[model samples]
Target: MREHPRDPRAAVIEERIASRPQGSWFTDPDPLKAEGDVRAVIDAARAQGAMPVLVTYAVHHRDCSGHSTGDLTAYHDWIEGFARGI
Candidate 1:
């Protein structure tokens, strides 16, 4: 948000957040579940005058089980098909 955008990370993060599929749940991990941890991340990011981003991930036990969205094809297919056209 700084003038002229010295922080390129801001634009990238914002665009990613905006382009994400609707109703998608992209929150910080459990360690960052605490208010203090989240605040620390945001505060550190803000010090650089950049936007903050919340990224999500899954353990994907199904990968080993060959059930969950295990591979790139499966991931891309699901993302395109189910992901609200994001």
Candidate 2:
């Protein structure tokens, strides 16, 4: 998994997970910082010879009546940023 700035366990979890010889899954949970985050994760994965899988979770009305709702414009920009990162 990618290291998220807001996740308290990000560093520890990433260190443990990154040691495995497997792909890394990155999620764009924060629109404001997702671009840089994605880029960093991709770079790190590539350095380790692992494929990076990006999981975009921000979308308009995501999760239906549950949490994770986002604005359409924001999602659009987020997606653009995500592509740029790749």
Candidate 3:
């Protein structure tokens, strides 16, 4: 992990649902729809010499969706990494 510092080039992205932490069931595979799209996002970033600090999140629950304090906390860190990398 890299140390945090202020920079305009940085970016942060996050998704959260409010009981479980992020990626409680994060599969290794990317979402089907996201597969191609994410590559494109990465390609665009690379084309411009931008750093890609990628992180994915998933919340585990009885159903397909749920969240907890841990999820939000994870979201914060993921976004921070993304932003710092940028």
Candidate 4:
């Protein structure tokens, strides 16, 4: 991991694995699974007497430039779905 500074996923997985003693960990690989993932996290946090914070991701067309990007309508839809999830 020291040799892969730009690999955020690897860093997150490594941290999760190392923090096993602190709590159980879960990962959602599907980018389209945000709604369900957010709900799951919120439920888990509530169960532990914690408040959850959700940060949304890409809404428009992505992958063209190796980043999350989207147009106004797509982004608006994403935001709406996120709101529904909450």
Per-residue accuracy of model 3 over 22-53 as CA lDDT, tens digit each: 22122232244334444555676689796554
The residue-by-residue lDDT of candidate 4 on 1-86, one tens digit each, is 77887886997889788656443222222334555666677787789897665555454553578466546775666555555556
| 37 Cα displacement, candidate 3 (Å) | 2.5
Worst 10 residues of 2 by lDDT: 23-32
Error of 3 at 50 (Å): 1.2
What lDDT score goes with residue 30 in model 4?
39
> Which pairs clash inside model 3?
11-83, 19-67, 19-68, 23-58
Error of 1 at 34 (Å): 2.2
Off by over 4 Å in 4: 1-32, 59-67
- In model 4, what is the error at residue 68, expressed in angstroms? 4.0
RMSD of each: 13.1, 7.6, 15.2, 9.0
Least accurate 10 contiguous residues by lDDT in model 3: 18-27
Clashing pairs in 2: none
Estimate the TM-score for candidate 3. 0.32
TM-score of each: 0.28, 0.60, 0.32, 0.49
Candidate 2 structure quality by residue, lDDT tens digits, 1-86: 34468788888887997677653344555555777877888998789797877776555576766676767787788778777777
- Residue 8 shift from truth in candidate 4, angstroms: 25
Runs off by more than 4 Å, candidate 1? 1-33, 56-86
lDDT of 4: 0.58
